[model samples]
Target: MPFLIVNTTVTFVALLSFRLLVKRMYALVSNSKQESYNVLIVGVNDDSIALAEALSTSKNQNFNLAGFISFRKDHQRIKILGKPIIKYGSKFYDRIAPMKITGIIIAGAQLSITQKNELVDKALANNLKIFSVPEITQWTDKEDVTSKIKEIQIEDLLERDAIHLDDSEISNYLKNRIVLITGGAGSIGSEIVRQVSSYQPECILILDQAESPLYDLELELKEKFPDVHYEVILGDVRCRERILNVFKNHDISVVFHAAAYKHVPMIEKNPKEAVAVNIMGTVNLADLSTQFNIDRFVMVSTDKAVNPTNVMGASKRAAEMYVQALQQNDNVSTKFITTRFGNVLGSNGSVIPYFKKQIENGGPVTVTHQDIIRYFMTIPEACQLVLQAGTMGNGGEIFVFDMGKPVRIMDLAERMIKLSGFQPYQDIDIKIIGLRPGEKLYEELLSDNSTTLPTHHKKIMIAKDKPLDYNIVCIHMEDISNAADSENDSFIVSKIKQLVPEFISKNSVFELLDKKINL
Candidate 1:
């Protein structure tokens, strides 16, 4: 009887305290001469409704609910909480002054940078502060985001539209399966591990040679997902014996191959390492996946593999060919898939983080060329699409991601500087360094002989590339392996050129090899 009374008293006291708090907040709003912000919420939907309620009932905050701005085309004159919700149009500026709106809150709406910038600029002209409700990108679709509000961010402008995923399909594809992630300590690989862990996979085996990053991942996975089972093995993809042993011991249902050297200039200087890792390492994994009878093998490829001017691109192209040829063999049961995309933002050694560090250190940010442009995707966004594409693939498919429009490096630098509250060329100077070896002005998603077929996901497409004979491709693969064993730069470049005839060198010593071949 005493325990029941105590529980009942506690519940009653909590309700009583909330009622008193609301009463006090109402009195403060009524009497205080301080300017209260009549905020306009953006995009009226399920998420916005919750935000409106929170704002209405907030205490110790000088906020008054005005109305919502409909960024969607299907705008309706709906009344939310006795406030008028209006559509944003040419007359929006007129309505804003009448409504006495002091601020704008974008509630989980996906607007392009152009559209958002226009709105923010117009609101700023009218003296309105902009805030946004952040969304949860990974783990779950839970949007418990109405509790807090934050000022706008740089990612809010640069990141692409909010992607809608089929969660049920993703769960079915990953649940209870032993997923093996090669290079699980890297940006893309580590994100795959996190996303995969959320789906309750049977076991997550992370294979990476890097000790520090792998150990850090182990700590994060254990702390964030204590229930999820995972094991980390310090192993390199170049070692066939180590990878073979992993496949032999674990019943790995799926594989995400992300291990490879990727820096173009470094790989250009040392093409032998690129051959050994990007080419030979991929060969080891592809051959072992076939031998182990793994269900799905997803290889992370690059947009550089399209036209292939550099040895890095050429090496990755050779690996792509080896797997596609292996997939063409009638006897192989493993479904081989390759996802090709351009630079991932905020990835290790990517220009954005490098620029951020340089900006913090006080002046001169370096751009290779003023005209240089490349596609950008966030690390999490790329991994989400990878999981989605992995579920959608059957066999022998190179999935091309729709990476929106290419962004100029110069523009990116200026915007980043401005976003950091500094004037470009005044507070910070961006130096135009000459293009390095193996660097290109722009990146292409498709080669001349390939076309894309649309998939269920609008952001992903299947490339119907030129056909290759399995026997001939395998013969060149062996020859490249032998040339790599010889450790001769000319020998490696010669064999790679034979395998990928489109491999023309640019701004490098290897261009001489191309000239000799042309002569």
Candidate 2:
């Protein structure tokens, strides 16, 4: 009886100590969280629950979970982790500051664009920063949960569902192959370099004229993809001797030809540079790829290439024709494919960043035309589609991506202002400037004679290309190249028009050339 009493006493003391320890831990957690910035989590679903659980732990260094924001009014009764979920409304907007909320974390992928816009406008008004969890595919278990919450980007707002990719096909084409990406320092080319590196290529040859951007890309690749081998060549695509040296030195199997003059207004002003770079640069690559017997040659073209109205567009179309015609040649063995896409969302000099800067300046935002609309895809999406197209093309095909509903420039400007915590026209005036030279109100993916046929990939389609005669295309391309050498803008543009009969100049001095042709 004495032994039993002694045992019970010891057990009781141990239980009491354990309970005290639990109390102490709770106190510490409470104290630390009090010192942290309080954050509200939007959309309390599976994703948000995971985020909340992570933030609840001591591992989250920056934020303390305050409450949840519910999209549905009925979700108010739902309590997650002993915290009440408040329905988002006008009342909630007023309570944001009072609640000590410093930030909002959007975790719902199903949230519509309209809801996102409303949330952004309200959050910015409250002087709160907005964050979002990255897509599930973007993170690994080893990655820190808090680090995955990134600032909500404008690309996230305009982008659609993540595109489906055929991993095996892309890997098969890119893996262990020596890849050459022309214009590798440009926005599109840089993204292509980043994406292709993930596929484990043999070595990536980054050829470009821009020294600073190329150096920056090298630093990024070393940090992000340390294992990927790359060579940065400071050379222009316009130089045949320089290009020939690159081809001779590297056993380049795959060519992603992204080198070209893209700005419509600038290209319209100097048609010589347009023809030299867009036409002859493409010609040099195409000829070299065929001569060296490269496996696949993929050229990145623009939607403006269809029924081109500017020197830039016309030149791109000319390049597209030359590439298509090469595939028709019985003597050529290389497969040349072209992928045409619309405006990349945040590329250099794109309207999104331009508007963002104007909004930051706190004044009038410029819109070329009130009715102008354009389809946009994120840079990564465009590059991903380019890779997918590269894998599927047999030869002589122009691939077009299905860019979802076009966005109006006027509406975009207003939404941007509101999202920046200001009222449009009241706080920031939107001035309508007339269309610049060679600018179009609408862009078309397919021409009158061409029709799209469905590919195995749902998002990509093959345009029934009417390939120009190989010999005839070569002769005209050579003539344009000669005119470019003479630095004759009118003569070069005339040759381009003759080469691409669909070419028509708009809002440009070259409109007079079109008139002359008609007369």
Candidate 3:
């Protein structure tokens, strides 16, 4: 009877101490809430719960969790670590407004683009700050999860669903292979380099004439991918001797040829340079690849190459033809593949940067044409598609990415203005400038005569075009190359038109050539 009493007394004292500690911790948390920023998290799934727990313990004491905003209907009404899920959908406005919520945290990748836009617009209206979780693929551990929360950008608003890639297939093709990227410093080429580096290639030879960008890329690779062997060659693709030397020195088996002059108006102004670089430069590379018995040669082409109406597009189309013709050579060993894609957002010389500059100048944002519609994909997405296309190609296949519905320039301008926290036309004026030379109303991924063949991946398709006579293509290419050497603009334009019969000029000086041919 005495032993039992003693045990009961000890248990009672321990329980009393634990209760006191719990009360003390709750009081401290309640006190902190008064000074902290109240945050309501979006989504109620496992990721959201994990994010809330991470934020609660973060060193940055600014964020205080208020509750949850249910994104998943099934997970609704459930408490996340004892925090109430007070509101969802339209009901959130009343509850959130009353809670004195200062910020919103979109905590999971389950939120759709439409949903995000609605929520973000509402948050902006309420004058509340907004942050979104990183992509689930990017998350690995509990540490640093809060650091991934960032202020959303216009690009984020326009992002499509994450692309699921065939990692095994890509690894098999790229592993231990000596790869070469021609324009390695440019936006698209640089992204290609970054993604390809992760696959453990034997070595990557970055060949570009630009020194500063190449240097920057080398430094970045050194920091991020120290184990990957890479060589930065300061050389232009136009130089046959320089390219030949590099190929001779390195055991280059796979080549991603991304070098070319891409600006349409600039190429229109200097047709000879466009021909020399886009066409002949490609010829130089293709010829060398064939000579070297390269395992795979993937040329990056543009959507403008379809029924081309400008110097840049015609030049790219001509390059495509030359590369395609090379496959017909009975003695050729290289499998030449061309991957055509639309404009990549954030690429140098793209309209997004130009519009951003115009917006920053605090005046009118210029649009080439109000109705002009073009397809757009993020730089990383386009490069991944390029790599995937390279893996899927058997020989001489032109792969076109399935860029979703075309977006109007006017709509894009308005959205960008709104994303910048300004009202379109009220805060910032939009001016519709006439189409520049070589500009088009719309872009085409395939020509009128071409048809698409479905691939294993839904986002990519094969464009089967009419077969070109290799001998004839060679003759025209030779003439164009000779004309380029002569630096005769009219002669080069004439030869390109003759070479690509579909090369019709638009708002350009070469339009007269089209009229003359028609007459």
Candidate 4:
């Protein structure tokens, strides 16, 4: 009995020692991680509070939430997480310069451009990595917390506020109108449908070749807007008779034509397919809209059409020319308009999803060219601008959204990597693959020949360009369409260049076709 009691006591003592050692180690780790980062929050508003909370909760051992700072005098006395807010002036930086501040997050709301620039400049001068929270409301709970905290991008530095549209005007045109979206199931087309539904359109006819996505969108719209009438038609834009039949049956008053083969690499390999859809499909819709006496036909175009370098761009340019030519004809009742913009951030084929997939797969993210740059807008933003353009269209006019400045693809990759909570070039390797077929080093929003005209909305501008002759354009289009039917790729591409002399080919395997077909 004595021996058993002694053994039990020994075991108890060992367990206690183990627990104490763990506790000490844990406390040491926690203390080591508590190293305060000299963080400077720009605005002491809700965004600042949320950012403070995020910083406090972050596991980064180096981060220290120093204090808050804002240009507004009212925010000076405001306390974020019990830290006093400091004014971002000369003395403020001087006072904090002594302390090692790893980074500065500008959470200012409704800040003037000059004020934002001053803060950014000061942060940079202090050798601090700068970040800006555009508005507190932009945040969502589901957002990746780390990724949401991003470096101050050029968009943030521009200090331009988001354009506010005249909702009444949009509602006037869209409400109770039978709307037809050709690529209704696609990223842009679906978004158009969504926004139009918000206006309580009389009926929405969603036409797309893709069955699964079309079905999904149908169900979603049906569930989300039970009061709105929705129709999902499984038909390709390439089918003229089918598209016309739908227009005739539904009496679609407003047509949002977004269907096209837009993937550059895929289109480069299948130039014929690109021509059939982007060009012929567009022509079919424009003609049907006019035939059906549609009120407006808004064709979704791209920056690629500016000076097309690939089959996809060339096809889109041809489509634009077709719509423009139709608009020139006095007989056509439909007011045709084109909305040209660059890549969307979270679209089906956008790089954001690609990078996300790669990151989730624990793989090396692939970037085409380190120096390549392109304009980007959120999917919803692009669609909203499209809807706004549709309302502002007088006819034969091309509206381009102010996509701000172009973003370097490499820098975007780096930011995304950092946002993913991984040290770029350390945790995730970014592989620079050469530019793909029809891809550009940088995308251009407006050509030298194009001039901008202001609209009611600040973000949207009208591109002034000479209209093409409808008769001549139609003749060339007919020839191209005939060649497409013959499956004679060379004849079709050649005729396209003859119509619009700007078509150019890049990264294509068809060198013979490329040489023969010069725009």
Candidate 5:
């Protein structure tokens, strides 16, 4: 009886110790979180409530809802978890400037760009961070909550008012159409196929030289859009016979030409290939479209094509000129249109994917230059604007999408680092590497001679740039093609400049061309 009592007493003491340890651990964790953040809510609405609730539930996020603030007089003054709603204007911000407010969350209906700017400016001036949820109806709410909320980016601040598309018109042009996309396995091409498939295209012919990616995309599309007819063809666009065969075999009605060697470094090393594929390849497809009487040919061009500085850009500009030239051809039964835009957010070789891979590897994310900036759009938005441009085209027109403001690469890298749940400099280090060959510090949307005309879709605009004379352009193209065929890189490069005098070489051995040409 004595031994039994002793054993029971020992067991009871151990249990008590375990309970005390667990209680202490819980207190430590709670105190740490309480020390981390104090968040202020502004413009209470559904989004604000959702954000508040999310913060309340997340143990990892150390946010304390300080209270609410409003500019309007009629909004409800309800307490969220006993937090009071206070009316604050410019003076209130000054009063709370010294408090431990980590950030302000703005949520409500859409506000004018001017009003939004004013709010953001005030927050920055007071040394406080600001975040906003998209207006009620426009909110996608797609991002994972684990992703840290970011300050309002320059893109959000400088972009114009959102433009709504006429859905019926877009649907009418895409529905039941047999669409052919060159480079269909690539970034822009794949997105075009995806979006078009959503609109119930009768058949989508995906063509690319890369066999494996083409096959993979084919399988994915087959599964996703099982009801839509899909075909994958592996062929080079530079081959006239192959392009003609595909068009004839498929009876392709709508064409999206997105195939080209786009990497600046690669193109500079082999200028002949750029000319062969970008210039001659485009001509082959344009001429074939005329022979086959394709309904629409939408050519994807880049912002680099505006006063180009590299061989790749020059070649694309030449392609654009060729498409414009073909529009004047009486033999072509196709309506040729070109869409010009800038870098996509997560393209195959884009910086976003590169940064993501770097982050996953656990260390430093590299930026080319601190001051370098470029226009950006999401892949879906870029592809959607392309479709919108195609529907609004009048044969020879060049459509440019409004890509909002240019974002500095350094800033983007920092934000991406933060979004990945790492604090810049503390968790992940950023290395500033020098710019690559033929890379621009900033990209421009318009040329000296180009001007914009508003479109039915506010995001899409028409470029009033001069179109080259078809006869002259054709002669220059023939010379370029012969030079490429003969493996003469110098002659081909020279002819490219002659065709488009705006071609300027940066960080290239071909800089001589820029000095020689007076345009």
Candidate 6:
């Protein structure tokens, strides 16, 4: 009887307090001299209605309910809480202008960034502020919707619609399966780990040479997924013994090979290490995967590997050829898959972080060339596509991602400046530094003669390139490996040229090899 009475008392007190708070808020808004800005709520869903109620009762009294706008063609409701609900159309601005709508609040997260951007652009042109409510999953009982509202970010401007995936297909393949991710601490690799974890893998072995990043990743995965078993192995991919031990210890069914030296200029200077890691290291994993009879081996490739001009690009091309040839072996059981994409936004080595750092220092943001361009994908999006493609690959097929349109580096700098609330070349200067060694004006997803076949997924395609003999490719790789070990730069480049005839050097010492070959 006492427990029931206490519960009733608590419930009554909570309701009484809320009523008093609402009454006090109404009084505060009535007495305030500041004018309430007329606002239009986007969407007429439950989230929109809830947000409207919260805004109406908020103590800030900054927004006044003007009306609701519906994107749906069949939304028949004419009014919500006495405010007129209007359908969005070509005359959207014409309808809202009469009401003097000063702000627009996007109510739900169902709208794509492209759609939101269109709305945001129109609102900005008309001198109206724009805000978006957080997704339902992000909401908490203690926090109000108004508090979760925020201005759109630059990433929103670049985002595309979410990629569709066969969750059941992916889950079935991964459930209770032991998986291994090389370089699992890096940007792309870490995201792959996160995405794969959700599929309920039996165990995940994270192998990376970087101690700090590996430890951090371990801590994060442990905290985020306490139920999923994870083991962090701090070792280089070049160490065959260590990798073999990892494979021997765990019955890894799937392997994501993402470990490679990717920095163009740095790798150009140290081609020997690039050859050893990107080429020889990949060879190590492929050989072991085949020997161990692993089910799948997915290699993370790059757009640079297409008609490559840089040492890093050529090395990756050599690895791709080796892996492709491995599938031709009659004795091999593993299905080798390769995913090729361009620059990932906000990666540790990407220009986005470099520009951000330069901007934070209050000075010039350096661009390699005014005309240089590159395709970009978000880290998560790229990793998700990698998983999707990995599941869909048959064998010996290179999956090239459709990275939308190429973005000019100069325009990117300007966008970054504007997003930071600064005028380009006025408040922040974007200096054009000359291109570095081995750097190109643009990146290619496929070579001149290469063609792509469409897949079930719209965003991914299979690149059809002439197959090279496994034995011949292995012979060239062996020579390249020996040259790399001997630190013979000329021989290494020569062997790479033999393996990838399209490997032309640009603005570097290896350019002499191309001239000599022509002679």
Q: In model 5, which residue pairs have backbone atoms overlapping below 3 Å?
A: none
Q: Top model by TM-score, which number?
A: 3
Superposed by TM-score, candidate 5 places the C-alpha of residue 493 at a distance from the truth, in angstroms, of 1.3
TM-score of each predicted structure versus truth: 0.79, 0.86, 0.88, 0.76, 0.76, 0.84
- lDDT computed for candidate 4: 0.80
lDDT of 6 at 140: 82
lDDT of 5 by residue, 198-244 (tens): 88888888899999899889889878888889888899998999988
Global Cα RMSD, each model: 7.2, 8.5, 9.0, 7.2, 6.5, 6.3
lDDT tens digits, residues 37-85, model 4? 5667767667778778877886553447888776677877667688877
Give the lowest summed-lDDT range of ten residues in model 4: 152-161
Q: Pick the candidate with the highest lDDT.
A: 2
lDDT value for candidate 2?
0.88
- Collision pairs in model 3: none
41 Cα displacement, candidate 2 (Å): 1.2
Candidate 3 Cα deviation (angstroms), residue 292: 0.8
Give Cα distance to truth, residue 425, candidate 4, Å: 2.0
Model 5 TM-score (2 dp): 0.76
- Please list the residue runs of candidate 4 whose C-alpha ends up more than 4 Å from where it truly belongs after superposition: 1-42, 46-160, 510-519
Error of 4 at 102 (Å): 12
Residue-wise C-alpha lDDT for candidate 3, range 103-207, written one tens digit per residue: 888866678888898888888777677878875667877657766887566666764777779989889889999999999999989999999999999999999
* Per-residue C-alpha lDDT of model 6 across residues 1-519, encoded as one tens digit per residue: 999999999999999999999998888867586545789888887788888888878756668889888887666367788898878889888977789887888876767777887887667656677777875667787875666877555556665667888888788778899999998999989999999999999998999999999999999998999999998999999989999999999999999999999999999889899987999999999999999999999999999999999999999999999999989989998999999999999888898888878887876999989899989889998999999888886789999998987889898888776555566788899898899999999999999989999999999999998779999998898889888877778778888998999999998899999999999
Q: Summarize candidate 2's per-residue lDDT along 1-519 as a digit string, tens digits.
A: 999999999999999999999988987787676535678898777888888887787465678888899879899888999887988887887766567787888884857877787788668777787888865566678977877887687777874767999989999989999999999999999999999999999999999999999999999999999999999999998899999999999999999998888988888899888887898899899999999999999999999999988889999999999999999988888889899999998899899999999999997999999999999999999999999999986788999999988989898898788666678999999999999999999998999889999999999999886998999998998888888888668888898899998899899887888888899
Clashing pairs in 1: none
> Candidate 5 — what's its lDDT?
0.81
Off by over 4 Å in 5: 1-43, 50-77, 81-160, 219-224, 355-370, 414-432, 486-488, 515-519
